[model samples]
Target: MELITSNTHQNQIIEEDHVIKKANGNFIEANTLKVTLEHLKNECIIPVFSKDNESTISHYEFVLKTKEIVQDLFPEFSVSEPDIRTSHIIKGRIPSAIGKPAKELKEHEKTLYYERCAFVMEIPEVVENVNGNKLALTIGGVRAYNQENLFSKKSPEKFKVFIGFKNMVCTNLCISTDGLADQIRVNSLNQLSEAVEKLLGQYDRNKHLGMMEKMSRHEFTQSQFAHFIGKLRMYQFMDKTEQKQCFPISINDSQINTVVKNYYHDPNFSCSGDGSINMWRLYNLFTEANKSSYIDNNFERNVNAYDLTNNLVYSLQNQSSNWFLHN
Candidate 1:
């Protein structure tokens, strides 16, 4: 039987005060706006994914669809070709079938496979010059063998789209929630352009720049940095009310300390003139650990890393009002 796919093409405008329109017919928005990645997910992404459908879209197919949607909506931005990254979670030391292609290995022989495929498109040069930074949009899908749901017979994949900013001088990747773009799962055939424009229109470039500047200016002393680390560690087990949980597994203080030390030791992080540490550096520290810290099949590790990163960002945003209020 042949598979059938639906075409979802639609457009609508959203009135946003923070959106800035350039002379060249391009617009830029800030990440600090009320409309955030989470809000976008709840508003558009979740509904699309929840639609009733007989067939499910594969990760590869979703990437292609997203790429097409993006290119069609914004013709000016330079979009990158789609790329797939696969990691072999289970491999045997001895070769079972030497003649067969490595890519054709069976699931039982391989045991588990992990994949994170993405398409990165560059933001226009004009926008970059205006913002004083280089930026890119990443639309990607992730699927690990253990994360798959076969028994439930549901879609066994996930999708996301976000923006990344690179510092012009320091060259550090400041990964923030792609507030300008929607980070959502490819669940159904739905209108993409309207959802994208609505989110983009909410971006206030000036507000985002101001927030970034604030993060850069605030410097943490040695004692302050240590306190930050303590807060980060505590946040892992505590709830929003600062109530601690009794987990089955013991909390590893040494591992947390090692992760914290690794961030400051890294030379790429931004530092104040007085040699104090910046929030951007601290933020990257969590992001890097989240992405590369775990080699084993501990899915919970990634979840915890994600949560930690969110907590860190929230703390930085309201450092003056109430630091660690969410913990």
Candidate 2:
């Protein structure tokens, strides 16, 4: 068995850049959040309301949308998913620069957790790009370029700018889903509980997404080693080391790449949980006052996600073996 390096560490390598810089004179807290590594459980959900409209929450379905979050991880990455059909639930699917009519999801025997995450935020108008024309920019499903996707979730609204990280680009499609966070709006506790149930259901559905990423890293690296290729087929690494020391087996790694790849690369695959931070609680910084960005705190990595780093993680980046960049 190959040794597993924790994703907690890989996540650390993926740091949230935070330097207090001025955007529009108001000095938006343009940095990572203050959550500690210990506080960030794989499924830890933190909910935040808009700064201008405290009564309403910003549509964060964009988080799980691969294109929405991919640049944060790899600024060079670009999303190619084009067809993402519109859900009649909203108006027709949002239009884009691509040709051909919208497309339907190419179902896999196995679905993904990000799909559920995408669904949670898809059901909102903000994710629908309501202010694109006013901004003279495209935003939402294909080209989400509106303030709601940016500024802190609160009342009256706060303005901020997020300059693109690298040579990355985005195209929006009018995608929407049923508000899984609508739990906050329920008049009765019972109805609210139903909303909570929907969020939990999505969370629980793909309990192994974390493990899958680790596994993919391993299998992908080993594929080139013809000698070991035969033994390198199983694609998932997850476990509980100190079972008695603390929490139970909370989740696993499974199909996370599928989720991200689909939402970021496959347009026909549009839905609620498209891989961007699929849940409302995932964006807890909204409640953070005194100025703080999301992912401010240091996060810890699980041990099972790093074995491949020993061999492939850095070398084969940009889809090729660039010797100058690696060793």
Candidate 3:
């Protein structure tokens, strides 16, 4: 489906503030530090393959190239400054004619490069309001040292790209399998660009949004909510044979605890005074808790949240025998 035309003048007014708010809220308690695009390009060191002179694609290059592609495809969309995360730092000291031990090298002589990076950019103009919460189109990718073999010849580098919605209120990503390219192996920038373009071109935005809208129509009573929590907690300990019969959930016990806490305490998504919660709010609770995940695991878990919640909503509407929903 074609993107809905946005109000340019009004979007410009709130764009900066919106970017700042999202940057501040995202990545709390996570294994990453936020950085600006300029900082990433100018301050970070580019890494080279250990066995060859060839350099791997830098994080800045990946993000910049993707941004260029997005701008070309959707010129009217206002892209936010990148929300960046870098970890697993590799440090070194410059070689000197007078050989010295590593401990003797001055701090100023030390150079560093991050071994992993993940980032997301939001298209604020491409937004949808579901039950009073705003979700904007977001695109991002991840690069990790573990995904590559630096000692080998110039092999296909690994990357992951995802297109989804970022909850404007909490900066929680909402993704599904349709929106994620989990294993993108490419040899060059051109190949990477093509991969990203194909993913965006094929995504069904209308169908995804329609599913989210349907979630608002399904509610969980206090009793049902309690049962769901108990069943989910038990599912983690269930045997593989038993788990295969039920809808899959990727979140861990800590995240489930967060969901139960938010069901009663979240300012915007909490259950109503009647002690009932809708699927949409419950879905957000799961996504919200996912912010604590490591950068490598975050997007995958976000997609799982959408899949799990979507199935729950289906069970609620069709009276299916989902283990979490049925008695």
Rank by lDDT (best first): 3, 1, 2
Task: Pick out the ten consecutive residues of candidate 1 with the lowest summed lDDT.
Answer: 5-14
Which number leads on TM-score?
3
Q: Candidate 2 lDDT (Cα, whole model)?
A: 0.23
- Which residue segments of model 1 deviate by more than 4 Å? 1-55, 88-119, 124-148, 153-158, 166-187, 190-206, 237-259, 270-275, 293-327
- Candidate 3 — which residues are off by over 4 angstroms? 1-23, 27-29, 97-108
Candidate 1 versus the native: TM-score? Answer: 0.53
RMSD of each: 15.7, 21.1, 7.2
Give the whole-model CA lDDT for all candidates, comma-separated: 0.40, 0.23, 0.79
- Tell me each candidate's TM-score: 0.53, 0.18, 0.87
Q: How many steric clashes between backbone atoms does each model show?
A: 4, 83, 0
Residue-level lDDT tens digits of model 1 in 172-285: 233333342323443454643344444455545455444554443334554556665676567566674554432222225555664566555644443333445555445444
For model 2, how does the per-residue alpha-carbon lDDT over 1-327 read when each residue is reduced to its tens digit? 232222222221111242122233211132322222222223233233445433322223222332344233334534322112111121122233234333552322212111111111121111211111110111112111232232464423221111111100122111112211221333233343344444333432122223223222322212132222122222222234534332221112222323233333332221123222211111111111111211111000111112222224333322444221222
**Candidate with better TM-score, 1 vs 3:** 3
Cα deviation of 28, candidate 2, in Å: 26
lDDT for 264 (candidate 2): 37
RMSD of 1: 15.7
